[model samples]
Target: MSTPAPEDCGYPSPRPRLSVEELPAAENTQPIRSLEDLAAGTFESDQELEEFLAFTCAERRRDVA
Candidate 1:
């Protein structure tokens, strides 16, 4: 039997194209001074800290990409 095409193999289709304006705004850039400042309670809550980390990771990915 013939193999099914990539789409017909049950994988989800690619995401819809989005215009630059339609995309989410980039995160605010922060200047990290030291490891102590990073470890300190700069963020108010756990959620805020998580968001900061996620933003940092996204920025790094974009830079590497």
Candidate 2:
């Protein structure tokens, strides 16, 4: 079996990829202070926990960049 090319896979390729230098800087971005806050067990429900995890992932990604 052969793998399909990006175009043959039936999804549109992202157009005009921008380099890091081409992207504009965000003025108000803030670093997350603590992952410990997510582990504090204060969430009342599973949905809250999922949202917090998602937020943590985004924060970590921003911090790395």
- Which has the greatest lDDT? 1
Q: Per-candidate TM vs. native?
A: 0.39, 0.36
lDDT at residue 39 of model 2 (Cα atoms): 74
What lDDT tens digits, residue by residue, belong to model 1 across residues 1-65? 99877689789878778666655544444567788767866779999989999999999999998
Q: What number of backbone clashes does candidate 2 have, counting pairs of residues 3 or more apart or in separate chains?
A: 0
Q: Number of the top candidate by TM-score? A: 1
Model 1, total clashes: 0
**All models: lDDT?**
0.78, 0.77
Q: Which 10 residues in a row give candidate 1 its minimum summed lDDT?
A: 21-30
Clash pairs (backbone) in predicted model 1: none
**Native-vs-model 1 lDDT?**
0.78
lDDT of 2 by residue, 1-65 (tens): 99887888888876776666555443344446788745767889999999999999999999999
